[model samples]
Target chain A: GESVGLHLPTLSVQEGDNSIINCAYSNSASDYFIWYKQESGKGPQFIIDIRSNMDKRQGQRVTVLLNKTVKHLSLQIAATQPGDSAVYFCAEGSTSNDYKLSFGAGTTVTVRA
Target chain B: IAGITQAPTSQILAAGRRMTLRCTQDMRHNAMYWYRQDLGLGLRLIHYSNTAGTTGKGEVPDGYSVSRANTDDFPLTLASAVPSQTSVYFCASSVAAGVGEQFFGPGTRLTVL
Candidate 1:
């Protein structure tokens, strides 16, 4: 079965630095991808999303890039802050499957002051 | 507007016991989802409802059930919990099936001992 997965399990970044998380998916039919941030003791929150039609999308201090050829997706956070420390997950979905999303294992990000 | 709300922040239950986790969203979204978060496993969908009366099984639906009695609520029930059922459960709602962003609830932490 096709799945979504992250390249790294953990990432430590200095405050004010840029952070990037990578994800790989196996389903070529997937057209919608989303990034979520999960803080301790809380549910995952929507960060940003990009569709297969576009290569990239930008949000508040965050950007999502999609590479359909490689089935790869990434989330970049600018000026990393301590508040940004959390577990990040990438999910993929397709309209064919009623938009049911398949989520990656997750990448835990830690910011140093 | 209190996007989503879940009951019982945490719980510890013995094996064979039954439990129901509550979830509600004021957004009146048309789609609701239940997912379980485990160490190294990220989030796995258990069940989903496209609308008030329609339901579907997801990746890990065994031992769990869900009901969408109305637009504002989607509750997940565990029939005879087991040790493997110990995990954090998150409830989410989207504007419509396969159409928009998903808003998640805080989550319910369940430990089946």
Candidate 2:
């Protein structure tokens, strides 16, 4: 079955440093990708998204990069902050599936003070 | 304004019992979705409704059922609770279900014993 997966399960970074999270997807037909952040004891929140036609999209301090040829996606945070500690998930969707996203296992990002 | 609200913030149910998790959105989005979040496996869609009175099964929908009585309310029902069904459930809604961002609820934590 086609799925979205993360390369790393956990990432620790110091405050004020840049952080990057990587994700790999198996579905070639997927055209839409999104990144979500989930804090402890809360539901996932949207961070940013990118379409297949575009290679990168930026939102605030976050940027989403999509590579269709490699079936890879990434989320980059400009500066790590204590509040940025949470689980980040990458999801993929396409028109063929009515845009129902397939989420990744998630990467836990911990920002250290 | 409340974007999305889920009832029974947490629940502990016994096996074979029937339970329904309520979800309501004030945004009046046309698309609603129900997803379960597990430890290692991120969020998996259980069921979704493109609009009122229409429903579709998602990645995992065996023990769960959903109904979109109207554009504002979409409830997920578990006919027979099992231990495997113990997980945090989140309800989300989007404007029309394309590449648009989906607003998520606070989530309902269900523990089946």
Candidate 3:
């Protein structure tokens, strides 16, 4: 399944439930992708990152899945907490290029207790 | 240490007024970027500097200009403010270019009247 911005786009999960946020990268040339979490009245923070060579990577309780064939990326948060509620942005980076990061519109996550 | 701090956290400016959003990074990163985030549209790159003393345009660079005079500062200036330029501006930097994660600042919210 592809995680375009508009397909099953918005996900709502109760507190403590696992949450999955998805994104689709358009450029096959992108070799690096990063997930950033932006909370209210704050800036985006690096959550986790994965290279195109790897399909899955984990950090703490967060996991990032990359599918190159379909050009998809997904972030899974285990035991999603209330503090996890924020907009998540996925940015794609190209190795051959300097420092151009193509960012998505961002997905707003709401956690309900 | 202040990871990254933006001046005038929020501003209200009149049309045709000139405003400069200051971004200072203490990380001593070689690369820095400026992006503007709109409501529906994703974060669009305005300008970027791979290293100090050089700059380049990004996806959207028409209304913005940037200067990387030194290693720690990258400021974005709007010659003449316009309503279309009203959006949240973010400053980000990465330890390395090509393939690496980026750390972002708190962001500046600008509203042009």
Give the winner by DockQ: 2
> Chain A TM-score, candidate 2?
0.99
Q: Which portions of model 1 miss their true places by more than 4 Å?
A: none
Question: By lDDT, who's the top model here?
Answer: 2
Docking class of predicted structure 1? high
Clashing pairs in 3: none
lDDT of 2 by residue, A32-109 (tens): 999999999998999998989999999999989988889999999998899999999999999899999999999999
**What does DockQ give for each predicted structure?**
0.87, 0.90, 0.80
Task: Chain A TM-score per model, please list them.
Answer: 0.99, 0.99, 0.91
lDDT score of model 3? 0.86
- What DockQ would you assign to candidate 1? 0.87
In candidate 3, what are the lDDT values of residues A1-113, reduced to their tens digit? 11224234357889999999989877878888888898987888999999889999999999999999988899999999999998888888777767488888888899998
Q: Which candidate leads the pack in TM-score?
A: 2
User: Which residue pairs clash in candidate 1?
Assistant: none
Q: What is the C-alpha lDDT of each candidate?
A: 0.94, 0.95, 0.86
Docking class of 2: high
